[model samples]
Target: MKNIIKRNPNTMPKPVGEYSHVTVIPRNSELYTFSGQIGNDLEGNIPVSHKEQVENTFKNIERALLSENLRAEHIVKVNIWSVEEINWDHFDNVWHSFFETNPSMTIAYISALGLPEIGIEIEILAAKPSE
Candidate 1:
């Protein structure tokens, strides 16, 4: 059985999805944490737009999740980083296309990504109940 977990927030807009903005799992569940994923495609070329980068990053996370027979819905926390502050509108469009709901998020603006063409990176933490 799966559960929805919501974390603390005060006087802010409610999340636009069925999921809580954050989630907590019991200690018994199996946990998985992924390294930060950048915008580079499998060929090692980065995409030109923020939307493209975000899409690629999400795909990468999905691939990782599949390896464990989990899905994006299992994600408990997400940290997003961008070379410049993300434009929320652009991000929202990209986000909605891929994720049916938003997971818990922490977003940051950074001076640079390790690669010049990279615009975004996403790190994820997820859990699934042990069989």
Candidate 2:
């Protein structure tokens, strides 16, 4: 985490969400790009409510990081796509529970996903300096 730098330049307006405008990854770092994760349980059951799906999506992100022996701090960027209108209040709670520090992020509202049952999906880019 110390190897990465997150910046919000004075030239630009402050970010609307809890995220940095720019992230700098150090040279010689190992980067990992994960596929977009959806809100499904191990059994592939997606919740009906958008709030529940949002929560589950973060849980899945955690699992993805753990799979590579990485944690939230290793995350450099997050990209989110949602079919439903996001409830920021509920979404923030779930987001804060996972990431203690801000990361570069992008979120977009779209008409639909690959499946109707999926309300949201998140993909992340993570990096760590090679030991």
Candidate 3:
């Protein structure tokens, strides 16, 4: 965790969201890239409420990281896209539930997503030393 530095540089504008201005990854680290994960269940049913959707998405991300033997703390960056507006508090809660350290994040409200029923989708990058 010490190898990954979260920077809020004095020269750059202060972050308006719950994230660092930049994330610095050290050399020789093995990076894991995850595709955007939605809130759909195995049955193809999506959560109805925004909060539920966000929660499910978080679970999906956690499962993906687990497959690679990585936890949220190893994540260096994250990008969240939503079809509608989201409550910052809820987002913060989800982040806290997953990550011990806050990784660099970018959240965007968009007109549409990959799925019509999905309210939120998340993608992340994680790193570990190459063995």
TM-score per candidate: 0.81, 0.95, 0.89
Best by lDDT: 2
Q: Which residue pairs show backbone clashes in model 3?
A: none
lDDT of 1: 0.77
Per-residue CA lDDT of candidate 2, range 1-131, in tens? Answer: 24788889999999999899999988889899999999998899998999988888899999999999999988999999999899999999998889888899999999999998999999999998776
Query: How do these models rank on TM-score, best leading?
Result: 2, 3, 1
**1-131: candidate 3 lDDT, tens digit per residue:** 34777779899998887678778887788889999989877677898898888888888888899999988877889999998888879878887777776789888889998767878999999888545
Question: Which residue pairs in model 2 clash with each other?
Answer: none
Runs of candidate 1 with Cα error greater than 4 angstroms are 7-21
- Which whole-number lDDT from 0 to 100 does residue 126 have in model 2? 98
Per candidate, the number of residue pairs that clash is 0, 0, 0
Candidate achieving the largest TM-score:
2
